[model samples]
Target: MRQNPARRNALLDAAIEVLADEGSRGLTLRAVDQRAGVPTGTTSNYFSNRADLLEQLMRRVRERLTPDPAALAETLRATPSRDLVKTLMHQLVDRTRRERSSHLALLELRLEATRRPELDPTLTRFFTSDLDANVAFHLEAGLPGDRGSVLLLYLGMLGLIVDDLTVPEVLRPHGVDALVDSLVDRVFPPADHHGEEVVGQG
Candidate 1:
């Protein structure tokens, strides 16, 4: 039988809803099937087991959280790094909103990864890749060696996102800009930031 693309995505989407609305403990192939309106076996068909489902969901969430590399690089090449950070921060917030379900899925993944050492490698790899890449992006913004600091702030923002503590409007309007500036100041320092090569290949 040919797999249905729409149905497959529906199952995953339903799975996302299950994670977001019901938490990880509530995520099951049956639950996803119920939410997606597909047969119970449909979700299982796409995923082999519970771990497979969560892993796939985590992948989807990371994909959702990630920025467009080609575009970001091009923009970075043309724009000042200082300005880029705020834009990137704002964009992340928007992406989070767009993939709210995935966001919750990621949280569940994190919790699971924390509890299970085996999953830690995958989970850490996913989030660290984002942090490492963004830290590289920050360096492109002319902030040198600020990866650790940026990771912290980035994580802080993520926490706000997870807890629904932030209002995107305020974040972009003033909060994001201020955050960018403050992070740059503390992490880069004026003296350290003049003409340094952005970390990584940026």
Candidate 2:
């Protein structure tokens, strides 16, 4: 049977909502059907089992979370040097905030990756572009081999936001800037306060 694109996406959207509200354990066929306003049988027709549904649901998330290479390159090139890395960091954090349901889905998969190492490789590969983009910025700041640090900062931002959401004014005045700088030091060990760079081919 020919599936309607609109209906298919609606199902994926509903799945994200479900996963966010209740986590992976609560995402059931009946719940998805109710959220999509489609029949349970229709969902089964598309995804025959829980594993199949979970895989496709994550595939949808990958489509949403995976950074677009062109956009990444454009941002890296166009942004001004002064505070540019910090600005890009904020932008990435903001995107995750905007599609928070997607972030929750990513977190759920990340937890699963702990037990299933095979899954972790593929999952981490999906997020590599974002990590590499930040690494390039760190390299420009004179912090070579800083990919691990940038990834740590990215994760830190996630944790910060989670706390901020759960608790009001947790970071105090000027705290965020201090935290961002601290992140840079911890991750990009050789980061110079002021540095110059050539427009990198990479």
Candidate 3:
């Protein structure tokens, strides 16, 4: 019910932290209030209930993870190629690492969604729209891939992120950057002289 955008955003940010640190079960108005350093009942004033808080947190996480428009525009100016896709993937990995808390909170929200059927539709919509947008972007940019390539890239990067965040040790030997490069190379392999994709080529 509160109309103060800044305060509401602060509360949502705090909720993200709480979700990351304590999981969904520990998310409560009092916990958010303490995390945000606000007075008791402050969060309740902003969020109607636990479900409302979770929904808002999901939106906030998306906002926090969005790519920088200026940087994206700069990248788009370069010729579209596998290198360009690698650059974008690197940026995504870097952003995910930098916004560790938000990403972790996102994982928590996804897990919570499994138990709360009411959340399925919202999460599904968000993921589906994001995938569609990504596919459209790749096609428009003339990237070296189709919808299937984009989907594979998405799944590969998602797995990389999960492993990088949850268990870096597993990938430390291969290195995150190397793994990303490998993922991009495999998903968007170089084309042959005839402009046909060469799959499984060394």
Candidate 4:
């Protein structure tokens, strides 16, 4: 029903706002329609049911949350592997800070998926795509990280984002930058070619 991409994105944006404000239990077709300020039945016309709405919402989040190619290319060109890890962390913190609502909605989806076995495939695919893309990025940038390293870094960043958004005071005084630097140091530590300690040295 979204003959226009703008309208579709607007509705998805509305859904994210609803998820952030009202939680997953409050997300309904009617709620999305109302949140979008559209006529009744609008969301149902676009999305057949809650599952459909959630699937589209997941897709939209992926599209919106991915790193910008041009910006990433420049950063990769100018930064070393260790500094690049810090840059990635900065990007995560900045995006989470700026897009708190959307990120919150994503967290809701993760929890909701845990209770819905049918959604496991979609969730798995979504995360696998992220991991695969991350691996590709690391390879292209000559970053020090294997798939396992990506997994660990991703989990750490996800936890940091969740904490930053929910209980921000928990990370007070030290701040996100300091935490990120620590993570970068630990995740992509310095290594010599002959030294067998680093993850990506194969």
- Runs in model 4 lying further than 4 Å from the true structure: 192-202
Evaluate model 3: give its TM-score: 0.96
- The reply for model 1, stretches above 4 Å from the true place, is 68-78, 116-118, 136-146, 163-177, 192-202
Residue 24 C-alpha lDDT in model 4: 92
- What is the lDDT of every predicted structure here? 0.69, 0.67, 0.91, 0.83
- Using TM-score, give the best candidate's number: 3
Q: Please give each candidate's TM-score.
A: 0.72, 0.67, 0.96, 0.89
lDDT string, candidate 1, 60-107, tens digits: 666656778887677667555444655665666677777777776777
Better of 1 and 4 by lDDT: 4
Q: lDDT per residue, candidate 2, 103-158, as tens digits?
A: 77767777767866767667776667556755675677553334665577668876
Task: Please give the distance, in angstroms, between residue 151's alpha carbon in candidate 4 and its true position after superposition.
Answer: 1.9
Q: Name the best candidate (by lDDT).
A: 3
lDDT of 2 at 13: 81
Candidate 4 local lDDT, 99-147, one digit each (tens): 8888889888888889888988888898788778877877777777777
Give all candidate RMSDs, comma-separated: 5.5, 6.1, 1.2, 3.1
| Order by lDDT, highest first | 3, 4, 1, 2
Name the lDDT value of residue 145 in candidate 2. Answer: 38
Quick one: RMSD of model 1?
A: 5.5
How well does candidate 1 score on lDDT at residue 89?
59
C-alpha positional error of residue 24 in candidate 2 after TM-score superposition, expressed in Å: 2.0
